[model samples]
Target: MTLQTLANAALILILVGWIGIRQLTWRPILVGRMWRLPIVFAAIGLFALSGSHGASSVTAVDAALLSLELVVSLGVGAAMGALATIRPLSSGDGAPDAPRFESRTGWVGLALWFVFIGVRVGIDVWAGALGSHLAASTGVIFVMVAANRVARTAVIGLRVSRLATVAPVPAGAR
Candidate 1:
């Protein structure tokens, strides 16, 4: 199969990961573990990167684009992640680290997720149609998944940290 096809297939998989993520309800997503969606995204991101890099020799412009993608993706992802509805819940043990949480952005969150996905798909389609190597570049797909995960996880972590600080002590523990 052609490299472009391989890369596009990989790009399509990223959308699958996002769909799975959207199905989830925000409940202590990162509290005890990395969770399935992000893990899937990471694995998928890495796999796509391998396809992008192995497909051909990367150029300086490709590297620059990758860096730019990273910056934009991360910035956008961070904003989206921060926008996620994260709030602490009372865990059974009442442990500081064991934060119970929930997330919901309603229509806005879904719209944002779709917007990012649409843009990524559009880029992949446009580049692949022209046989531009950018379509096969690892950076584009990698940033799409990695940066979003970073932002969401960071937001969850930050919110959890804030909650831990002000949380009232559990009855017996206090």
Candidate 2:
């Protein structure tokens, strides 16, 4: 439909593909692949810029607020990613067959990006500048995050169950 809606849909698809890639490969597709993430981010940025309502209404205060939101979201996401990355390593767990998905930290990065979209949508809505464009963009962000996390959780649960089923029983059996 609208450019914003299209952009949002593209972002959601990217996130889904990102998660699947991580789960199946246990690594980020971007790492030596280089140009991919940058290309995707650039495309999304261009889409957002093109559909944005313009900077006429973005006062210094609004800019500051958006900046703060971005910083906080990024910080939180980075912290989470770092924590997730370090957990298995620090636990002295034997090395995995392949490095875990933490190689690129894409999940946290995507979360931060969604947070930015949320703040932008909130600001636009508050300013009465929202239309179908903003609504669609925001809706896609929310839906994608929710759906992706749910899928991840389900996958994790299934993996755990499968592992338990295959693990050998201890000696001294009943």
Candidate 3:
């Protein structure tokens, strides 16, 4: 593996580790804030893919594998989001228009994260065996991670919105 590849792998592990810790704790579900990380990751992925040091070429097999990975990422991310536990935020803790729920992924979400990582690793191995370098590159991994996070955020946002619709409005706010 190249130095860049090693650096990327390390970076990914650090990111996942940091986020995993937060996922197990109760935190306010701020859909807007959730977007920043994915967007940054996507930008980095785009940069890597376009850089000379990254994947030089994309084969048909690479494309197919990437598509497959994307699908799996989305599926797993959605499952994680769906499994998240959301509780109403305490009074006076949020602004009138702020999100009312605090969400935690807990054990189940962590398990899903493992499943996602396992599937990603499996696909990467399969691609390497097929000589699809793109699949094994950092760029592809970043993109896939971004896609997964986006999927999770979307599902969580949907759930939060549903809750908002059904929840009674505070008397003062009305």
Which regions in candidate 2 have their CA more than 4 angstroms from the true location?
1-10, 13-17, 20-25, 28-39, 50-53, 86-174
Task: Kindly list the per-residue Cα lDDT of model 2 for residues 130-164, writing each as its tens digit.
Answer: 32332233433443334333333344334434433
* Candidate ordering by lDDT (highest first): 3, 1, 2
Q: Is candidate 1 or candidate 2 better by lDDT?
A: 1
Q: For each candidate, what is the lDDT?
A: 0.60, 0.42, 0.81
Model 3: per-residue Cα lDDT over 1-174, one tens digit each:
667557656866876797789779998878999999899989998888887342666778988899999999999889988999988776543466576778999988887887877787788779768977778777877888899899999999999989888985464442
Candidate 2, 125: how far from true, in Å? 5.2
TM-score of each: 0.67, 0.39, 0.88
Q: What TM-score does prediction 2 earn?
A: 0.39
Residues 63-126 of candidate 1 have per-residue lDDT tens digits of 6545655666666566666777765454456555554565655456666666666666666555
The TM-score leader among the candidates is 3
